[model samples]
Target: MKKLTAFIMLIALTGCSKLSMDNYQLLKTGMSYDEVTAIIGKPDSCEEALGTRSCVWGDEQKQIKAAFLAEKAMLFSHQGLK
Candidate 1:
């Protein structure tokens, strides 16, 4: 009933997240964090340490991840994006 309908809607909405193969491809090395966020929106979570940062968008099963050094993008990868 209503609960089931809500559940399905939740899944549908999550599926429409900004994290996708197309957006992930827009990433490039040397892009600043602000530039990266402008493309994929803010990350779901991020961690910083030792003058570097790691950020992730979306969830565990479907997500885009980036590693930054000197405040610029150094590497980017994704999981379960389709």
Candidate 2:
């Protein structure tokens, strides 16, 4: 029973470790792709078009999308989990 309880606690803590507003605030316009990745870790996925790229982070319920132009972040937005 103690082992089971410990495992559950570990899972709960891990789930709560997703991106937060503090991490979002670290982003700034003109930051390079590598710089942004260093702050938020590698994006879960990415898309590109016409010299513009958008990277997505976090799970479906709560996520952030950052658009890059010329390999630098131009804008970003976030959605909270519901």
Candidate 3:
């Protein structure tokens, strides 16, 4: 069962990455994108409206994500993707 053992080890290592999101921080209601990025680093995705924006970190595999807001600067948003 060397293959079985290898599969288990792979799963364990993958789970470690998912579990490490506990260290992330949430974006506040009025915080700007720059400030949020400063706290949580760059985001993997983002969304933007006329005067609002949101940034997201992490991916579907990892739930540890953050968001940010901006008024005039370019904003990132998650939309239109199926």
Candidate 1 vs candidate 3: the TM-score winner is: 1
lDDT, each prediction: 0.93, 0.87, 0.50
lDDT per residue, candidate 2, 9-42, as tens digits? 9999667644778888888999999998887788
TM-score for candidate 3, please give it: 0.43
Cα lDDT tens digits, model 1, 1-82, are: 9999999999997687688898898899999999999889998899999999999988879989999999999999999999
**Number of the candidate with higher lDDT, 2 or 3:** 2
| Clash tally, candidates in order | 0, 0, 4
lDDT comparing candidate 1 with the true structure: 0.93
* The candidate that achieves the highest lDDT relative to the unseen native structure: 1
- Candidate 3, 1-82: lDDT as tens digits: 9999999999996565322323332434465656656555666766666645555566664443333334423333322222
Better of 1 and 2 by TM-score: 1
lDDT of 2 at 60: 77
User: Higher-lDDT candidate among 1 and 2?
Assistant: 1
Clashing pairs for predicted structure model 1, backbone only: none
